[model samples]
Target: MAIEVASLPLPASADPSKFVDFGKEVKGIDPGNLTDDQFKEIQELLYKHDALLFRDCSLSPEQQYALTKRFDPASENYGHGNNKTGSTVKSILHPDLKTIPRVPQVQLIGNGTVYNHEGLATANLKHPSHTTFHKTQVSQIDEDAGITRYYRWHIDAALYDLSPPKVTTLYGIHVPHGKRQTIRYDDGTGDELEVPLGTTAFVSGKTMFDLLSPELKSLAVRTKVKYAPHPYVWMAPARAMPTGLGIESEGRELPLEELPPWEESKLKVLPVLWKNPVTGNLHFQVHPCGVMELLVEPLPQGAKREGALYPDGAHLTDIKEVRELLYKMQRPAIAPSLVYPHDWKEKDLVLFHNRGVLHSVVGAFTKEQVRAFHQCNLAASDDPTGPTADDIKKYA
Candidate 1:
């Protein structure tokens, strides 16, 4: 089965200078029943594209697990990201629903908390059009769901555990229709459009690295960014700008010292520029908000620097400087040309490089919507810590 995976359809009105369809080589992949050779081919395509979107592929949980295992033999088969029970990703609307899904690995996620008694998502309709819901109202909903308080931009691993996940597969179970919106502007003017719903925005670290000023790029490549292990209850940051109707988790890292000890981990310093083990491309691997400190120096002679293993540096970059540069570096990487949200379709399984791209959920499913996706993450196949520190020096 030659997989026919396609790059996301380019935006209709994209500027030519900005947008490049990187996934051009792939076609629509239909793995009626995956073979070992086909799985290998899929791996090849994924490394090449950095992202792949499979549509209407009604793959079951067992099949999904098998495909993920194929990608990385060591991938965790635990159910619902819980290591104890090892559950599956299921379409459950709410966490409170006592009905445990049949599959141990199948766990339910989405805005089940906002659904009606019949399990339909009509909370927004209860307030009439989205326009009536206003920012104050929506922000309150978002705040309740921990978007304003807990959700923030980060690599999933940096957000949760220490070791970063390699590959992530998100299977869209249900997608909501975008509500009509008329956004009033500061100029007393307004714009009309349907809000983008349940879409995930992505920023490529490699692209961000390339876009950096030569001096900054050199500094970034040479520097080692120390990221504190993120807290279990992550406080959210308000975005500088809007990405459609949803909020963007922007700004600096929250203090971890005050948080529980178990919630924190020893700070790890990774090379700012990481080279991909599979594709051999260099990535700007540092997280904008997760950075706690910066070692503005190269690795020691004959030192191990992969997976962010390095001794502390005396010369440190100001946390403020790092955060500002990170924000600046991130902007272009998320420019209209570079940024593409997953315009999900029912049963569309999207496989993306977790290390390579920064992503965010868009539209407005804070607590009361029903867009479900079965997601699985694989541990790194190659060097998870990333490129050698010498590589950073050589490039710098």
Candidate 2:
């Protein structure tokens, strides 16, 4: 039987027209064992919708890794490199991921102790909390009152030598139920969202690009972002904004001289917008926290220059200036109305286009609230494609 595809339930604030095809629930097929034809169909569905959900799936780590690798056949390493996070103890990511010894590409994550999970005899996992990384956080009294915040907004990538992953797979092996929580943006706009406990919140990069005014769109298509070398280590000493959108410019980041040994030639300079391979649509895909510079290209010849931002080519190196520019371009897309906070269930598997969306771990779990999950994403074998000359001419 062919897979059954249906739209996921959206919040009342969502624009039905824009979300008509954003995320889908796939039924009538087993994700662990897909036929060749089924795999092709799944691929088409993933690119078209960006996120696909499979409920009540009994997926093994090996199966999850195999499925994720299918999207990028040449990829072999974990998104951050095998056991790399463990060695980089100062990295902000060190506390969150535990590599599965058998399948190094799959990570065992979540909160509380898990016994005999895959190759692990006994694993103690800690849920990443914003209190540890943010400049400020909701107080204990407020948290007990069900107030929380998004931990971080990002794409899964090493953001160094490796290419960004094409997709990410997450399997909920043991899901715990609890009271719902409220996410307070705390950026002074008084934005708040009621989210399910431990929800994985998502915001579409396509929506991020589409919501921009024409001028901003032109600017986005003409820009590239440069990431700091060993970004996680570099940003470890820093703190994030209360909204969790990006880092605050407090001059607390590790100095370049203090960062782990890095090479100028190995720094990543990627386009601000990534072109979707199947749909040909451009996604605003920058990882806001890691970005340190912007390279804006001049407008194409014969294109209108009036009311254009940086019509002449320019390089932006001021950290505050760079972050403010990115925040201005990306913040609107995370409004409650545009966000998708998936309420997970045990035995559920979610596959998302890593290059097409920004996601965050939301809410918090008590020490006793145990949750177990397997996540897999591989560093892609190739770099993302940028806008073509024709695209530049049209947008400019």
lDDT of each model, Cα atoms only? 0.50, 0.93
Residues 1-396, candidate 2, lDDT per residue (tens digit)? 779999987866566777876999999999999988999999999998999999999998999999999999999999999999988998989999998999999999999999988989998999999999999999999999999999999999999999999999999999999998999999999999998899999889999999999999999999999999999999999999988899999999899998889999889999999999999889999999999999999998887889999999789999999999999999999998888989899999999999999999988899899999999999999989998888888887
- Per-residue lDDT tens digits for candidate 1, residues 1-396, read 344554467654334444353443244455436667777887877766677777778876556656766666865633224432112112111221122143333333445443432233332221112222122333554423423211223464533344566666666667666542212221112321222455565667677777877556656655767665532222222232232222223432345554434433444566666666577777776555556566766545554544332233335556556565566655556554565545667887777777776675444443455555565654443435555656555544
TM-score of 2: 0.99
In candidate 2, residue 68 scores what lDDT?
A: 97
lDDT of 2: 0.93
Task: After the best TM-score superposition of candidate 2, give how far the Cα of residue 23 lies from its true spot, in angstroms.
Answer: 0.6
The superposed Cα distance between candidate 1 and the true structure at residue 143, in angstroms, equals 14
TM-scores vs. true structure, each candidate: 0.70, 0.99
**Which predicted model would earn the best TM-score?**
2
